[model samples]
Target chain A: MDQAELAAKFRNKDIKAFERIYSDYSDSLFGVIFGIVRDREIAEEVLQDVFFKAWDKAETYSAEKGRLFTWLLNISRNSAIDKTRSKGFKNKNKNSDSSFYVDILETRDKTEIDIDVNYIRSMLGRLKERCVKLIELLYFKGFTQKEVSEELDIPLGTVKTNNRNCISELRKLIQT
Target chain B: MNVEEYIASGILELYVAGVLSEEENRDVHAMILKHPEVREEIEQIEKAIVRHTAALAPGTVPSFEFIKTHTAGKQVPVRSLQSKKTYSWITYTGWAATIVLASGMFFMYYRINNLQQDIKRAGDQNIQLEQQISDVRKDAEATEELIEILRQKDIVTITLGGQAIAPESFARVFWNKKDEIAYVDVSGLPEPPEGKVYQVWSLKLDPLTPTSMGILDQYDSDNNKIFALANPNQSQAFGITLEPEGGSATPTMDQLYALGVVSAS
Candidate 1:
């Protein structure tokens, strides 16, 4: 079933629908969580928490508000960020650098056994480093356009246009 | 309003990012419904972001069953049912019989209260027992699967004998050459020290080369202590070494805990 139909079922608290959503988006959510937390076990825990939270608050989810994937993505990112901010997590991860998502892809490329690392490398490799940073801050980190503009030292007016062009580049890579 | 120009303005990307204000979100939501191209573009943007992030996932996603159990206990708020309050002659008789059979009204009330507490205690114990039973059942299922894997005819069982550093420590490797997977049972190995983990290696003897299989990060909590690691190498031997949490590029020979050679079959 498509996401919209499944989402409606999910809102109704259907276990099968919940399972379908988990099967479909859990991996991507895991990736997003892992990118922010930078720890597999913690990421796994946060991923589960995000799903549980989503299921608990499923009533609040409206198709008109956003896509189901986007809603889940926001939950995963926020939970992961919250984890990083916790006192225990802060003490544990004091040495962890605020690495970008590309760093994760690069690390996985070397260490992971199952994934097709070359596909990831090639998909992300073609984009300029500037585009990677823009996508990272705006999309992955959930930074506002103004925040990304200041972070990257680009003009505030051009943030939207630049992000659009960068995402266009990403879309082309995905198409290929 | 220029829909094309608005689409080009990257507002859709911001909308999907969820960084947009409620007003902006409503505007985009309205635009998406009003314009097909806007909807399609939003879908494409969501898809790209999903693909981009999913690529960064380290390994296998957690099992759906695992996640299902975690969310199973979520209590859905049940709407209260309206019922007419009627005096029940049968319930009154039941209470009358108990009260008469007991000593006095106050005594009967105290006894009933005590019984209720006992029942609640028993109910709590039942729930605990149920949880234990489920945990045991899960362990049994895992063990059964591990046994099934071991019983495969083509599977090669290699006994990794304890090395000098940890002579008492031993492990078993169930290698399926056809599948290129090795299930390493490290039950015999001692718990790794803090800040250190056991890294499994696939070894080629002639050149004494060791290719890292993976680290046993879940060693302590793993009930089975059996890790399924991918070993695509033409491994003549297998070795386990204690290394820093992330594992070492090369095996720390000094901390080598277990070493075993595959018998020619």
Candidate 2:
């Protein structure tokens, strides 16, 4: 089935749809969660919690609010961030790395990443450092448009447009 | 309205990030429905972000089975107490200590009754909720089993289309030749007339012979509507027909509701 049909089944609490959705989007969501948590086991725990909550709350999902990937991304970020703030996670990962996720392309080895690692690295290579940071903050960090503008020291008007331009650049790079 | 300008405004990017306000999100969704191009633009942007982020995914994450086994029937809904208690104490005392003592005892008796009633209601509700949970669990378990059975590579799936007697009625047979079993799914069939039941049959196309597999006795109660019938015949086709309550001695060609020949796999 197409994504729309799959999402309809998912909204109906179909377990098969959930399985297919897990296969389709779990990787990207895990990456977003992994970027925030920094610890593998905790990220895994948070990932599991995220899926559990997603399945439980699937009935409440409305297509008008957002696409499924964005919804899953939002849930992953919120869950991972919540995990990081929890006392258990803090005690477990006291010395965990706190580097920005924008540097993942340059820092993480290829073997540890996905098959499209080189493609993403090249895409990030082409993007300006600020562009990469903006995507990371806005997409992975769950930063609001206002928060993004504040963090980047740009006017509120520019963040949306600037992030737009950055994603457009990425889309172009992907096609070629 | 300029579609390209709306696409260029970058709100779609914010939309994908979920950073847009509720009203803004609604507007974006409306535009997406009104203009396919807007939807395409949003999809392209989402693809870029999904791919970019996915590239950083770990080489291995837990499998879907991890989710299945972990989350199965773990949700026990929190019950609402739904209690309404109103207190009323207007005492006219001839002697303060005696009045207070008497009122205190009266209040305790009344409070105990109210508490007992609440406890009883809560207990009944808990039983009902547990029954519902178990019923749902049974349905889910049965469905999971059927899905596993259907996923087997050796199962031959034959779609029995509606016949002239009931053009709208249909069924499916999952024939496992090695196991000598055929699962008949009769979800699409209409309710049979009173005193008549739908009987499954294994057919031999060359000789035009029919053998009664079994009647769907629990058709009304079966939520899954899948009946596993023991079929040890070297059958070439499968059919379902409305027959007498106990079934017929021979083929009921006139009553054939659905029929399909097993294709060469």
Q: What is the TM-score of each candidate against the true structure?
A: 0.54, 0.54
User: Per-residue lDDT of B100-196 in model 2, one digit per residue for the tens?
Assistant: 8999999999999999988866754554465456558768989999999989988999999999988988999999888988999998889888899
Cα deviation of A62, candidate 1, in Å = 1.2
What's candidate 1's DockQ score?
Answer: 0.22
**lDDT of each residue in B1-265, candidate 1, tens digit only:** 3787799888888788777655567778888778989989998998898888787676788888887786676667999998988779998999889978775777878989999988866754554465456558768989999999899998999999999998998999999999999999999999999999999999999878899999999776688799999989999999999999999999999999999999987
iRMSD values, candidates in order: 14.1, 12.7
Off by over 4 Å in 2: A91-117, B74-265
lDDT tens string, model 2, A54-111? 9889987887889898889989998888887877665333333444544453335422
DockQ of each: 0.22, 0.25
TM-score of chain B of each: 0.59, 0.62
